[model samples]
Target: MNGTATHRTVIIVGSGPTGLLLAGDLATAGVPVTLLEKRSHDISNLSRAFGVHARTLEQLDARGLADQLLATGDTITGLRAFDRLTLDLTTLESRFPFMLITPQYEVERLLERRAREAGVDFAYESEVVGLRQDADGVELEVRGADGTVAVRRAAYVVGADGHHSAVRREIGLDFPGVSVIKSLFLADVRLAERPEDVLTVNGAGDCFAMIASFGDGWYRVMGWDRHHEVADDVPIDLDEVKDVARRALGSDYGMHDARWLSRFHSDERQAPRYRVGRVFLAGDAAHIHSPAGGQGMNTGLQDAANLSWKLAAAVQGWAPDGLLDTYETERHPVGKAVLRSSGGLVRLARAQSPALRAVRALVSAVGNTVGPARRKALGQISGIGYRYPALRGAHRLTGTRVPDVALAGGRLHEALRGGRFVLITPDPQAYEDPGTRKDRLTVECWASGRRTTVLVRPDGYVAWAADAPDATAIEEAVAAAVG
Candidate 1:
């Protein structure tokens, strides 16, 4: 490795959400991150994943970007069941009371801006052609816009590239899963009878239709028909996709010209492990599933957030090398759960027989029942149900994500703002500890009379909590977390 041209921390790909989020987090932590992308410029128009869940909003809030996101996107109060059944997610009790329905293009733009503002170095139109890793670090071979190749080195590397990740392939990580089903006709079209307010779903026969009004007259409609087939040579036509929508929704409803159209086949896959040697994977590179719960993109962004902090800690020499291993241990199960939930949703939508439809409706009804049952179902879809397994010697509440609680001064989430670890103590005296640094961990006093403690990460996830305030307990939790 030579002198001037090499980046201290180089990310081998893109303006995409996963890459950008990681870059932004690292940049904000005072880490110099070089983000290389093959795209010449930012993507202006793309109709990919659009639903941003509540948990993601909390993460964005920590970075001071939640208001910006909500301003641009519609606050989806709750997903409507069938056509008329609204779930009223505004009552769900989250920092973000509702899901943010913004297109993927906007998500990318927002993250890119945040990354730039945080000082992430950009190398557009540059692609990582090859990478060589040894005991020390990784040497990446890149080809720039002018077709000139150069070697870039970093202490570590991340494979945030998409489903067909070149980084994963180059690193030879195993992604085991299958293309479970192949049926698609996805489009963004203007409908004659544009459904006002909420999203809709009509599962009748092999005719599966899901439509949501992302404002404007435009609606994202996805449907499937078993008997109908696309010609081998023709890419899925917008007109064909719209015809399926018109047929499934109702023949009388005329489907007009579409703004965008594409075909998709669901794949249920996950990397065997998120990390191998010094390299790691995130986003679509680690897992890919149906977009039913809008979990695919959001999950990837969360992966970036989880890994960035651990990586920054490890690279800065403040944490144990084993801190990085927790990434896979924590996220792999979540990925498995996603595969199960999304795959089930897809199967329910694609179930053609009368018996299956009846069974699905009954299950849905049962799941939506009041109290705990309703909360669980809503939690699953909203990405709030996730909790990592507790570590050894952890308090009963430790490792369990802290419940979103209210405080007299502000909300528990407010203390977690600015992408830092927050230690919530019932006693304000914990702040007097001399060894504890304010910059590394912020101590906030909870006005709630309960003498409990909570530690939250930059992503707004509760990493550790205790039933009572104890300096030893808090210090141990901090050591476990950052170490």
Candidate 2:
């Protein structure tokens, strides 16, 4: 039951969205990447996620996938949270100001296609049974669909497997967290009557529920019953979903013809470390939280975006010292923040007592009326407000997300398509010979004629920015960042 060992520059232990993106980025950057997945070929998870947020859309746009994915779904500009607060995404500064309501499988299909085009070597039905990492490389014992065991060695391995990650288990990392909700029901059903809103959710009585379009005739519905607690193994019927929807969402919308149904629990957990030696974790393998904010998949995609370039740099031998460590440092805090925010949304939806309900209403009042509070909430939910930790004496813009601004050639996102560090300046001649890595850097001028010159990372965060372009400083910034 054993086969010979094989080697790859980087091995990814899952083919989910996160793993696919990371593998694609690495492969596109001319690094050898192999992806291992336990699932069979052509299998889809029935699309657990429906709403792709604005920030994630921007990430997709950078890879030339946003428009194609947008065609497969509908869009919503405002998101209703806990029934009272509506976060308006139309005011967001990115090119994508609204969330796309599509099945998760659409995203997977697109990402997988891109990954394939980028030359990612994929081994389907190859499950990671065990993982061990040393100083030089990581070793993975994989089991194929035929039950034959093989060993895969890689300079680095990323586990984007999921909440029940074999890589995390093999590595002995603690995923300490509590179950935020139990007996949660999710289903895809045909709704004879369409809801007024693109996304419908409510926290009424003992039920918390949400329903959104899958862009076809079916609607994706999710509900949790506070009074009727049951184990996940118990089968859920359409009538049960109808009852919950009636109570929580006010009406079932004449929902019929259940295509798929399941019951599960949501856990709020984050790994203490995203990286251990040469092994890394992304997506659900690193964090999981309530789906209240529609951030489960979005956050995972962002994690891949943040980690992929750093990984590419490391494998290509140009990454600055300790650049790999920033993956955990930058993302762990975001994961923790997501857990808190999504957990808070779940708790607010589950509030049963009069005092808690009043507090919820007060929060709603403030969030709806207060400008700063609303913007902050929108920022958190949309994933646009987050900024990485800035270096000492760095410019205020450093680590902040660079909005999709127009360049002399095209949009900023277009310039980032090849995963190169972008240096935007008013005077290109100032840094004509800045001694930066020419292959890894793309120089562009602002179409709006701005004076400041900014170095943007491949993942679309500001690495360094200067009010006025200085050749020495620009050279130093490029050398320090895009080495």
Candidate 3:
């Protein structure tokens, strides 16, 4: 307990996808970030998540990382669920309209690389055992590999740890929710005869199974048995997994050579508050739910993206009042919605009663027949429907994610890689000189006949937009957003 205490700009606990992305973004913006992780530096081959949706791909594209990640994964233009409903991504309004199917480890690997390139200091083999925050900053008590305890102080602390987060516990936050399903088995193995579909999922009366290839020879299989209510530590037999798959999928596809296998229970839980003073919770530390729609890791990554810019603004001394608090106000609802949607999917898939199954079939038929309904459902699951609340009197485009527009320079997302707000105005003379706020804002003219002036946040959300030039409103909005 005698090790020296050190101070950092931000201390991020847990080096998962959320933590890594946040660290990379903050560090890229010149905020000093220290990442503390309990796991070793070695990357794991086994992965629980394998799909990245369109909105997430756009976020990655803003950082110039989508293509790199896309190269490692396969893509699916449509997804079928419940044996009747099909959600097509081809009609999505984005450069990447398909879901990228790759192991979660691939994502972590890319984010880790980005974080390292941004000069984020990683303290592996360090676990945060306690946290205390005052008016100015937070103090973390960390236990290192050799049993040495040290205090690390930071202006802010973010808990990106998994469900059992020490940081969340240290702050006395209650993770309130219940387990939705138990006795789910996860396995990665070789498929003797691969399915033609990019991802295949089905649920029978009492069981459900999903299989997706990693683009490699191995395929991931997840299934649940209604009768097997055993503890997580109980050994899983391949025969049992195949049995469940056969029951739910009607065939096991000659699965063999199990590389990894385990059992876990999915819970629908959310923290009462994402922020308690200067300590904030994100990713699984804030919310978790059933993996029915493959939304868990994608939701966490989006949370990191939403928070990184605000934290950077704070660290760099330009954040406006209440800007930091918006993190919880904006994201908590999204987290809760994800929990509900995923839970609903799980309940529908696990329904054993004949009447419930009939209801599922009816709903699927409606979803398939109704175009608007299918698009809405697809948007929700794919995250394209997410929109923040705009400021009162702001333009209608405010709070909406700006599409990747073609500009004179290049694509809209490509211009955002510099980590600065982009002001797109048809009238170049409508705004003040960029020289004054060059550190935080960039002025660009629309290449086409776009008469509207839009102020886009670093995260690609339209902060303020106007049909015509409003110099005074632009100045005031800029001040309120950046300072």
lDDT of each: 0.74, 0.88, 0.88
46-154 in candidate 3: lDDT tens per residue? 9689999988899899998899999988999987778788887898988988999999999999999999999898999999888889988999999999999998898
Clash count per candidate? 0, 0, 0
Show where candidate 2 strays beyond 4 Å. Answer: 1-8, 433-436
Q: State residue 439's C-alpha deviation in candidate 2, in Å.
A: 2.1
Query: If the candidates were sorted by their lDDT against the true structure, best first, what order would they fall in?
Result: 2, 3, 1
lDDT of 1 by residue, 303-332 (tens): 888888887776666766577898899888
Candidate 1 regions off by >4 Å? 1-12, 80-88, 231-233, 251-257, 353-362, 370-373, 407-409, 433-436
* Model 2 per-residue lDDT tens digits across residues 7-60: 338888888888998899888998888889898887464768888998999899
**What is the C-alpha local distance difference test score of candidate 1?**
0.74
* Candidate 1, residue 363: how far the Cα is off, in Å: 2.0
Clashing pairs in 1: none
RMSD of each: 2.8, 2.2, 2.1
